[model samples]
Target: MYLFLSDFHFGLGTPEAQARRRQDFFACLDHYADRLEALCINGDLFDFWFEWKRVILKDHFSILCKLKGIADRGAAIHYLAGNHDFALSRFLQDEIGAQIHRDEHVFETGGRRFYLQHGDGLAPADWGYRLLKRLFRSRFNQKLYSLLHPDFALEFAHLCSRTSRNHSSRRWDVDGWAYREAARAKIHQGFDYVIYSHTHEPLLEPLGRGVYVNTGDWLKHNSYAVWEDGVMTLKYWGMPWMERSQEEGYSKRQVGTG
Candidate 1:
């Protein structure tokens, strides 16, 4: 089975809340560790992650160890860079055998082709963020930022992440249409499933012969998506994985994967 999750934003909350999120995430990993083919994190696994030479956020050590265990078990770890945690280096790959991708990743699983991306700055109207994305991704800018002390750099990035989250909360009501349209375009281009994770909203809207899936966010929904045997299901953590004959029979909080 291929398990997909996203938007963890680990450092955004109180210390206690962060601990709880980590424990929950660990439990989720443990539940599927034995059966996982590849664990795909769509984006924002951390609120802000940057690897300076010989420097990383010490708080993340435990979770990193847990992921290392999974990697040792031989399941692939695919980490797609999200807007919040895009500044990556070879640390993940070297330490845990992760495959880090800056943008989209295309692969075949269960005999279906997948188009996976972090889904940031895809809206035609989001010109400012698109430009910011370019600026943030520049090699020169990254090098300049690396000159700062790791403490100050990570602290500043966390503050920026919190501000970005607050702004996103303010605009949450109308945040997902652009993602859906983008998914539609990919579906029309012949992908069986187009998966994304920036909007923090879980959706399983059918587009012609394919499906558009947003794995949602760990912050609010604790939602994820699973692909097995050529079938995809949108699921919530700590809830029963109920299968229904009709899409409308599910709760309003649940998304239909049909």
Candidate 2:
């Protein structure tokens, strides 16, 4: 099974809430411990992250350790650096056994093709945001910003968290068209499925011969999509995996197999 999750936005909420989110997501990982083929954290796993050559945020040690633990378990883990996290140096690649992805990645499972991305740096209409992303991702800008002391860096990360993404999560309005069009653009890629995470809208749209899936944010929907066999099913987390059958009077969440 290929599991996809994103938009963790760690360190942006109350300490308890933040930790719980991380724990819940990782606990979800434990369920996949035996069967998981690939674990894809699409993006935004960290709301504010700037990794100096020698420094990783001290606060995230436990979080990173958890991920490392999963990686240590032997399932191939892939992380697509989101707009929030770009400077993925040796800290993750060398220290942890994760195959980090900055742009896109292609992999195969169950005789099906998968195209994966964070989906933040796409969307042509969002030119202004894209410009900012470029600036953040620029090598020169990264070096310049790295000059600040760790104290100031922590403070800056906190400020940005309070003023930016956390403030936006309260509003779950989604860009339905942008994702649809983006998915449509990839219909001819010979891929069976295209998956992304930035939009936070739990969706599955069948476009011609291919399928598009958005794993929705953890904040609002508490939902995620699961692909088993040749089928994809979306189910709310923290609930029974199966829902009651309408006709058979039995619990099940099995929607269908694609």
Model 2, residue 102: C-alpha shift (Å): 0.6
Please report, as a residue range, the 10-residue window in candidate 2 with the lowest summed lDDT: 243-252
lDDT against the true structure, each candidate: 0.81, 0.71
The per-prediction tally of clashing pairs is 0, 6
Candidate 1 residue-wise lDDT, 171-194, digit = tens:
532467778788889989989889
Indicate which candidate wins on TM-score. 1
**Candidate 1 Cα errors over 4 Å, as ranges:** 166-175, 241-258
TM-score of 2: 0.86
Q: Write model 2 residue lDDT over 166-208, tens digit each, in one string.
A: 3333222265566667777776768878887777766666777
Please report how far candidate 2 places residue 250 from its true position, in Å: 23
Give each prediction's root-mean-square deviation over alpha carbons: 3.1, 5.1
